[model samples]
Target: MFCYQCEQTDRSDNLLLGCHSVKGNCGKDDRTATLQDVLIVICEAIGQYAVLLREKGVVDPTWAHRASYWVFTTLTNVNFNATVFQRMIADAIVLRDELKARYEAACTEAGETPVVPEGAAQFVPDPGMAGLLKQAPLVRVDANIDVLGADVVGVRNLNLYGLKGLCAYAHHAHALGHRTDETDAGIEKALAFLGDPPTDLDSLLGHALELGSLNLKVMEMLDAANTGVYGTPVPTQVRVTPVEGKAILVSGHDLGDLAAILEATKDTGITVWTHGEMLPAHGYPGLNKYEHLAGNYGSAWQNQHAEFAAFPGPIVMTSNCLIEPQPSYRSRIFTMGPVGWPGVRHLEHKDLGLLVKAAQALPGFATTDPERSITVGFGHDSVLANADAIVEAVKAGDISRFLVIGGCDGAKPGRNYYTEIAEKSGDDTILLTMGCNKFRINGHDYGTVAGLPRLLDIGQCNDSFTAVKIALALADAFDCGVNDLPLSMFVSWFEQKAAAVLLTLLALDIKNIRLGPTLPAFLTPAVVDVLVDKFALKPLGDPTEDLANAMAGA
Candidate 1:
C-alpha cells in the first residue's frame, strides 16, 4: 500500500514489502492504511466530478452531499465501524462510476476526451495491487504536540479536521435544500489544495487561513437557509426544567431533525427538550410555538458524560459533539443523520418510531421548576434591527466594546479561560457567542446595555454567520471597515467547522482574532507564520491580558 496523507510516512518508501514491523510500530495495520488511500482517491474522483457538473451548470446535490459526508466520516473517531466504512466505499464507487459515465457521455456529445480538472487524480493509486489490497488505506496516526508549537504535521491535521467540520455543515445545509455555489466551490478548491504537496511552511499556513475564510461563507449560507426556513430568531427565554413525564432530548445542530422530532412527538404526551447547541431552537418562533417544546438541558457537550447519564428520557443527536455515553444513558442516546456512537440507537432517516416507543416505555421527563431562565435568539436579523441602537450605545460610551466569543468546548480544563474572560469583561462590553462553546459562560448575568442583553447566544456554530453579519452591520453603521469597529473575535475551535469559519474570516482579512484552547495538529511552522503575519492571527493568551488588549483600543 502506498499513502502519504500524514507526515509520519516516509515519502521515499513506496513499497510496503518487509515494512510490516515498521507499520506495526506506527500502530496502523497495512490493510487499514491501504483502505484510507483508496478512500482518498475516491474522494478525489468525486471532487473532479463535482467540478465537471459545476462547469456544465448542472450541479448534482447528491454528489455534493456524498462528497461532504465522506470527508466528514473519514475524520478521526467519526467512523470506526468497518461495516459502515465498507458501505460508504461501495456507495462511493457507484457514484464515481455514474459520474464518470455522465462525463464521458457529455464529452462524446461535444466530441472530445473528458478534460478532468487539474489535481483531481492525485489521490487515485496506480492499479496493480493484489485482490486482498483493494480496500482504501487507513490514515496514519501522529503523536500529540504542544498547542502552540509550529509543527507542520500538527497544522495540517488541524486544517484537515477544520475542513471536515466545514464540510459537514455544508452537507447539512445542502440536505435541507439550501445550496451555495461559492461555498461548494470553496470546499472543492480547499480539498484539492490539501492533496497538493506542501511547498513550504508559508504556503501551508496560507492554506490553513484560507480554510477559515471559506468556512465563513459556508456558515453564512447555513445561517441564511435556517433563518429563511425557520424565521429570524428572537430573544426568547428558555426554561431548564424537564417536563415530568415522557420526553425527548434533541441535541446537535440539525434543525431539520429537531422539527421532525417536534412533529413526531406532538400530541403523543411526550415533550421535547433542547440540549447542547440545540438550546437556541427555543428562540425560533416556529419551534417555540410547540407548548411541549421545553427548555435546555446541560450546559454544553463536554458535560454530556455526566449530564446524559442522568437524562431519564430518550435523546437524539442530529449532528456532532457526541461524547461517549455512560451505561445508564447509553440506551437512551439515539443518533440520527451523521452522528454515530457505538452501542447507541441510531435513528435512520426521519423515523422516530424507536424514540417514540422508547419514550413511551420510559418514565418520561420531569416537570420541576426550571434551573434558571436565559434569553437566546439574537441572530443576525435581531442584531441588525438593533444596529442603530448598538452603534449609538458604543458612540455614547455605554457599550465600549463588542466581543465575538464562540466555538467548541472540550474536556480540557484550561477552557475555563473562556469563563474567566466572560466574567471579567467590563460592564460596557457586549458578548456575542455561538456554538456549544458559549455555554461555558452563558449563565453569567453580564447585565444589559441600551435594552440589549450583555450576553447574546447566536444559535449554533453555523450561526457564526450571524455573528459575522452583526460585525459587518456594525461596521456599516459605524461607516468604517469591520476591523475598524470596536470589536474583537476571541474564538475557540475544536473541530473542522471551526476551521472553515476561521478560513472565512481570514479570507475577509479579519485580523487579530484570538484562537484557542489548542491549535490544530496539522499545521506546519511556515503555515503558522503566514497566518500571524498576513492576518494578525494569534493564539489565546491569559484572559486578563487578552481582555485588556481587546478593550484597550476600543
Candidate 2:
C-alpha cells in the first residue's frame, strides 16, 4: 500500500514522503489504499474515452459530475468501503469500452487508423483482489517519479490533487441541482489532462496553475448553488448548548440531506442538530426555516469518536471525513452519499426513515442546557452588503487590519497555533473564518467593530470563495488591488481540498499566505522552494512572530 494524499501521512524515517505500511495515518488500510489508486487510474481512462467522444459532438454533461464523484471518493478519509469502489470501477470500465467503440467508429468513418492507447487509458482490471493489487504498483504515485524527477512528479500530483478537491466542491454543487456548460467542459478537460499527462515540468506546472483558475469557477458554481437553493446566508446566532428533546445530529457538509431530514422529521418531535462542518447549515435561510432544526452539537471531525458516543440519538453523516465509528455508537450511525464505514448503515435515496425512528426511540438530552451560542452567516453577501460601513471603519481607525484564518481542522498536535493567533488578534483586527478550523477559536468573544462581528464565520470550507469575494469587494471599496489591501491570510490545512484552495489563491496572484499546521508531505523541498519564490508562500512559525509579520505592512 502507498498513499500520501493528505497532510497527516507518515513522516517517520524512510516514510517521510508517503505511507507504505499496513495502514495510513488516517486509518485507511492496505486494501483500501490500493483500491483507491486503482479507482483513480480508472477515472483517468474514463476521461480519456469521454474526451475522445467529444470530438464527435457527443458532449455528455453527466460525465463531469461522475468524474467529480470519482475524484471526491478518493479524497483522504472520504470512502473506506472497497465494495463501493469495486462497483464504481465496474461501471467505469463499461463506459470506457462503449466510448472506445464510438471513437474507433468515428475514426473509421474518416478513413483514419485509430491509435489504441496503452497504460491507464487501456487498462483492463483483473477480476480478483490479487490481480487488482498487482496493477496498483504500476499506477501508484511514485511509479514515474524516478524517471520524471521529483519536481515534475510533484507538480503533476499538484494538478491531480487540486482536481480532486475541485471535483469535491463541484459534486456538492451538483447535489443542489446546479450545473453549467463551462463547469462540465472544464471537468472533463482537467480529467483528460491527467489521463494523458505532459512530460515537460514547465507544462505540468502551467496546468497546475490552470487548475487553480478552474477551481475559482467551480467555487463560484457552488456559491450560486448554495445561495440559490438555500437563500443567501444571514447572520444568525447558533446555539452550542443542547435543547430538551429527542435529537438527530446531521454531520458532514451536505446541506441537501440535512434539508430532507428536517422535512422528514418536522412534526415528529425529533429535533435535528448539526455536527462538524455541518455547523454552518444553521445560517442558510431554507435550512433555518425549520423550527426543529436545533443548534450545533459537536466540535471538529476528530472528536467524533467521543462526541458521537455521548450523544443520545442517531447521527447522519451526509458526506466525507467519516472516521471508523466506535462500537458504542456504530449501531446508531448512518452513512450516506459516498461516506461509508464497515458496520454503519448506509442510507440510500437520501432516506432517513430508519435513522429517524432510531432517534425517536432513544432518550435524547432530556433537559435544556445553558444557552451558549455563536453568530454565523457572514458569507460574501452578508459582508459585502455592509461594504461602505467596513470601509468607513478602516478609515476611522475602528478597524486596523483583517485576518482570514480558515481551512480544514485535524487532530495533529500543532493545531493550537490557530487558537493562539485568533485569541491574540487585537480588537482593531477583524478575523474572518470558515471551515471546521473555526471550532478552535470561534467560542471567543471578539467584540463587534463597525457594526460587524469581529470574527466572521463564512459558510463551509467550500465557502472559501466567500472570503475571496469579501476581499475583492473590500479592495474595490478602497480603490486598490487585493494584494495591496490590509488583509492577511493565515490558513490551516489538513487535507487535499485545502491544498487545492491554496493553489487557487496563488493562481489569482494573491500572495503572502502563511500555511500550517504543517506543509503537505507530497511536496518535495524543490517544489516548496518554487512555491515560495513564485507566490511568497510562508510556513507558520511562532504565533507572535507570524502575527507580527502579517501586521508588518498593514
Per-prediction TM-score: 0.86, 0.98
The 10 consecutive residues of candidate 2 with the worst lDDT sum are 115-124
lDDT of each: 0.72, 0.86
lDDT of 2: 0.86
Segments of candidate 1 deviating more than 4 angstroms? 1-40, 53-58, 75-78, 115-159, 195-213
| Model 1, global lDDT | 0.72
Please provide, for model 1 over 31-138, each residue's C-alpha lDDT reduced to its tens digit, 9 standing for 90 to 100.
544554456557666776666656666566667667787776654324434445556667777787787788778878878888755443534443444442642222
TM match of model 1 to true structure: 0.86
Error of 2 at 533 (Å): 0.4
Kindly list the per-residue Cα lDDT of model 2 for residues 471-498, writing each as its tens digit.
8888888999999988999899988788
**lDDT (0-100) at residue 261 of candidate 2?**
89
Task: Name the candidate that leads on lDDT.
Answer: 2
How far residue 60's Cα lies from its native spot in candidate 2, in Å, is: 0.8
Per-residue lDDT of 303 in model 1: 80
